[model samples]
Target chain A: MANMIDLIEKSEVTGDFPKFQIGDTLRVFFKIKEGDKERVQVFEGVLIGERGGSNKRAITVRKISFSHGVERMFPLASPRIEKIEIAQTGYVRRAKLYYLRDLRGKKARIRERQDYKKGKDLSTAQVNAAK
Target chain B: MTMGIMATKLGMTQIFIEEGVRVPVTVLKMDPNFVVSKKTMEKDGYTALQLGFGQIRAKLVNKPTKGHFQKANVEPTRFLSEFRVDEKELANYEIGAQIGLEFFEGVLSLDIAGVSKGKGFAGVMKRHNFAGFPASHGTHETFRHGGSIGMRAQPGKVLKGKRMAGHMGDELVTMKNLRVIRIMAEENLILVRGAVPGSKGKVVEIKVSTRKPKALPGVGGATLEEASKNPMKASKAGAKGAGGKKK
Candidate 1:
């Protein structure tokens, strides 16, 4: 009987999103509607956390602008999100990169992973194949 | 005083509409309700349809209950409930027919009744929402007391129906005018807009609301299918033009 509830949620799940980890930097292209006109806006930030699962999945993105930290959450399955692009991957052991909030200047920088393009290539290739 | 359907409360979850706004919804699974018997005005002094739900094993059925099902020419069910209907409305249902989710087609709101979760032997503060004694200035061990029942000279004794608490919850509770969010016929699920009365898996009776209906969340009162497809016009974030930005 519980499977019936899952069946309803499964229909709303979006499968086109590219796979990205928590410490990776992503560029999200989001659609914004203004006065009968729609435009795409870019928001680039580090993926801090991913919450929930299935159709309710959301991602927390943290960025620094003008020496101040700004955090934003977006529903991963929302139709308003046009696309997600992995900018840079970081080598981190934590599931949530919250400890970076305390560090600033050079200390706040994330260590770049050497072999990150392989995973991004595979995920984007799979997304293209699905389309 | 109308026909209703019995369903099990599945759980609650959040679903995002097309406009990227999240809506909290409670899921209900509707099983097949078999019409076990029909009562007529002249024969039973009232008109009603006796519906049965859930499946029961053959060996667990008692003789009288088995004979009752045999007389109705229907398979035995675990639970049986009756819904009173108008004399003219009785013609729409038969003794052995099944009721489906189509019975609630075009309904925008519902009244769901079920037994609430039990909280045994509660105090006045928890049960009746009473403002108990002040918790300072020598108030000790009597913070949860129900203060006063009546005036000193007026009525002398305590009032007959004073609000003191003993048992709480585990009683029939009816939540009225819950907005219907979505109905998935193929999955046998109905998504209602708010919290229901009981916990998950509890059987609840759902009926069309008797109160006046409210306008749906959309421009010019669009239907649910139209609102879902064009959620920007349906949600408040879109209706506010440029000022109402959703986070």
Candidate 2:
């Protein structure tokens, strides 16, 4: 089942993102359409959740905007995504960081992951099974 | 040439189309279909083409059927269905000539027929889509019952074809005007927009639709999917069904 979906959406996959796991702060450069014109918008937030496989893989990024919680989910391998910039990869445990939603002010801050490996690693473990 | 060919249903899956539109498509494996014989109007009183498809061992065929295949000079096919064609289009096909997925090129909509999965003898709720009595509120044995048949005195007897529960599915079913989303020529796989009759691995007859499909913007035509079931509609529906599936 996983192999069949991969073969079908293989062609749509383009531009791999950095290996930034959950709890990592990400700057997702997204392409938006305004009338007939197109522009890139950058969204900075903490990676809360990531699910699905191959071209269908999506990531949920949460950021507090104007004292209110805001979240945006984007398909990781979508053509609409121009690039993903890892602002600060956090060293955290759980697969999903939903608990961070309740915290506000200084309580929601994530510890900076000290072991920041240099150089861009092209090979990404993107063929994850849907959970 | 025949308006359509025989294929085995291979279940359903989702695939992406252009501009990232996810389309639900059913996979069908079709063998190379061939013309076994031609029924001429001068001899047979009607113009029809006998299409042979699917593989069968020579030893498995009975002596009579084996002899019939020998006359065609082609390998014995498991299924042989006759499809009527106009006298003019009949000239395009020759005995033993094969038809592939390319035959349906540029056709955006089609009809598929197959024997539906049998659900045995069912009750009124599942079989006929009857709204049975309420389950709660002290509903006794009449919960799943089929309410009432008819009133007393005047016409007391139950009306025929009243949509009552009886035999369900396992019947020859036809799904009309399914949009053709994609056609993988190399894989011989057609990705239709919606569901078709029957379960996985079941034999399905796919052809041009009799009614024009309004699902697509410009695609238009009609064809016969049940030529064998309704032989009387063969010539008329065959011509129309051909136009439906042809590019």
Candidate 3:
């Protein structure tokens, strides 16, 4: 928590990442470099959990594919993360959506947040309304 | 043989690299250190450089240490350490010359010497990593204790240096071949990959490894040459100006 550590954390790439918490459906734009070629890959999933703070902060994203549950952990400060976009917000009380892994079909779906646009700004409100 | 500097442990932090690979680094603050004295073969029968680190008020220095600093014609420093090097390298440095993080700039690896965190009167389970008895049906308070001291009458007295419950840590520990991840000259911080001995704020001696890595042949001496050439230029160009003084 020293000033030097703070300075070091500030030097890392915070990029213009969308603010989305747990239970929110999000899409991450990750940059992948192969040799001299660079490309962007998009991963869409539900924000399950987030841990740590500052430069060490990481987030867990889970998505179901072919009836198999897949989870990925990504460091927020990583340079590979080009951007993040909140596709939709879901209504949930818990901070982590780990229980979603056990549920399948009808039990796994999260209800859409009704007041998502109430407190948000006009620009974000429009995006949420469009979703 | 290259000169060394004294630094303080500034806690650990993580840094993400180009490929999104996160590296855990232990930050060390190496303040501007001055050469207090040099030991020549003719005088001390060995070649070494005595360097001082950290600034202190002149009034706080004792008379003996004051006289020692007076002999070297330098300001009083809080920490002093001697680094043994070859006599040929002694001519490169003088009594009043300064050393900083620039001395570790292209250095990939180094040897760190410091006193590890003290855990006083530790038991065999914690100190020596001995597998204590498990808590089961008949296990009692002796579960955490060392099982037996001796076998039969074959060994009358306990063997010397036997693994037992005793003092742990608070000893001079040298971690060798620790990679130097990054050197922020402006912040006077050297970020090293993996952990080093000692806790935060503890003084640590950072020295170039005597055994040079085959991958980096001239890195040790080249780093020193770069530091000697620019002195405090890196600090000036970076945030912290000369002598680690924040702007």
Angstrom error at residue B22, model 2: 1.4
Task: Report candidate 2's fraction of native contacts.
Answer: 0.03
lDDT of 3 by residue, B1-247 (tens): 6667799888888776444557777888888889999999999999999999887888899999999998999899988889987988998899998887668755667899999999999999999888898789888878888887877788777878779988999999998877665667666787776798999888899888766432222222235444333322332332332223332
- Native RMSD of candidate 3 (Å): 5.6
Please state the error at residue B177 of candidate 2 in Å. 1.8
TM-score per prediction, in order, is 0.83, 0.75, 0.86
- Which candidate number maximizes TM-score? 3
Ten-residue region with minimum lDDT total, candidate 2 chain A = A122-131
TM-score preference between candidates 1 and 3, better one: 3
Interface RMSD of each: 10.4, 10.0, 6.7
Per residue, candidate 2 scores C-alpha lDDT tens digits across B104-168 of 75565678989999999999999877888887898988877888888788686888877777889
lDDT of 2 at B245: 34
Per-candidate alpha-carbon RMSD to the true structure:
6.5, 9.2, 5.6
lDDT of 1 at A56: 81
Write model 1 residue lDDT over B1-247, tens digit each, in one string: 7678798899887666555556777898888898888899989999998988878899999999998888878889888999888999999888889888887676767899999999999999999999999989999989999987888876789888899989999999998987766666655677787788898888999899987544444322344554444542333232222122232
Clashes of 2: 7
Query: Which portions of model 2 miss their true places by more than 4 Å?
Result: A1-6, A9-15, A26-30, A42-46, A54-79, A82-85, A90-131, B210-247
Residue B173, candidate 3: C-alpha displacement in angstroms: 0.5
